[model samples]
Target: RDEGLHPAIRIALRAITDFAIPFQKSSKLYWRYFLVPEAEFTEEAIPQITAPVIEVKKAKNEVPEIKEELQIIKTMPNEPREKIEMVISEPKKEEMLTPAAKEPLIKNPAIEKKEILPEQILDKKALKKEAKKPKPKPKKQKSDKKEEGFFNKVKERLASKSIDITDIIGIKKDELILKVKKEKKEELLIAYNKRKITEGDIIEAHKKAKEADLPYSILNLSGIPKKIQDLIEALKDISSIEKL
Candidate 1:
């Protein structure tokens, strides 16, 4: 009657309680306290074991069936079978002297093409003329000029102030060439000074900007002259350079 427990467990408990051994029967008080009545348990239970009934089944021999099949196979008449073979021979290519069929055996197109003489395909006069004719020189490619930026004049003016303009020219040119917003450029310069941005970082940022279809040109710090770098280093405050 315990709904919380499995029916199989309840059935097992009931079976143990109902079929009492000599010792269990003698202990009336213990059985009365612990044993559950069979009527209180559910009839539905799993495979039960009571008496051990062993069934011995004799194995059937398949030898008689096999012998019968063999006899049937032997009684069957022998059927005649035909063997097949294939032989292929290429036609001999011999010159025919007869008026009809005088042409040689038809050759494979690939073989005929390989056997063709160079003289048959090329014109001797044309080959000689081509050899004698001078080859025209490759024309030098002129690079397209880039449009000058609005700050190009300002960059050039600042660059002229440098004692040796050769080293500073590249940096000046980059300043003019960069297409990024003025604020972003200032931020990059600040980041560059702080070592947050490197040459590789600038290049990678430029690539990412280009991929995103943004107008930006990266600066190459290494392109600046050592003299200009030294001058900047000597300067007490770098913020003053931002004015220029």
Candidate 2:
């Protein structure tokens, strides 16, 4: 039948069929789409990700480590060429000088001159003569009498009032006046008369009141030492109060 067609038309049709693409038998356009497989939803396999490796280079200016001991050597030319040896020893403590050795080393010129005097260089007979001479006693000073008289009066008052002032020795007049003023003297004397106060009790009372920082004064104590009052004011936690 192709022999009935023109030669050019035959050639054209052969070329068109050769270049055309053939569709599947189950294509949607052919009404057989159910026979075709549904479009697939697939998960692709993932390769593990890793960080790249990096190499560090050492600095060229780095100093090399030393592995040797350091030492010092000294030699003298004029000295004998003896075998030199190294010795390691602990330091030794210097010994104290004896009295016999130290006596000659005294640096005082007066003492040296005194040692050369004829009176200092005594014989056994002269020593015996000096030993036989009567020894003189140290004279008592006048201040000792004044101290004794003051203590005697204090003792008399302590005995009459039955107050223990044993711990109150060596108290000067100024100290006594500070503890017991002239105005407070009558009050202290009255307290003593009632057997409620002792000689050194007032000072102890003041110390306690100052330390505790109580609202009320102890035994009506007043006129606290300026040094103690300043210290109390300097404290952060404790509140300052009127001097007492």
Per-candidate TM-score against the hidden true structure: 0.18, 0.18
Q: Over the stretch 98-148, how does candidate 2's per-residue lDDT look in tens digits?
A: 333223322435433444666666676699999999898675666566555
Report how far off residue 79 is in candidate 2 (Å): 86
lDDT of 1 by residue, 144-200 (tens): 122143244434543464311111111322233332235323112211212133445
The 10-residue segment with the lowest total lDDT in model 1: 82-91
- After superposition, the stretches of candidate 1 with alpha carbons farther than 4 Å from their true spots are 1-27, 30-193, 217-244
> What is the model-wide C-alpha lDDT for candidate 1?
0.36
Lowest-scoring 10 consecutive residues by lDDT in candidate 2?
Answer: 83-92
lDDT, candidate 2, equals: 0.34
Deviation (Å) of 120 in candidate 2? 13
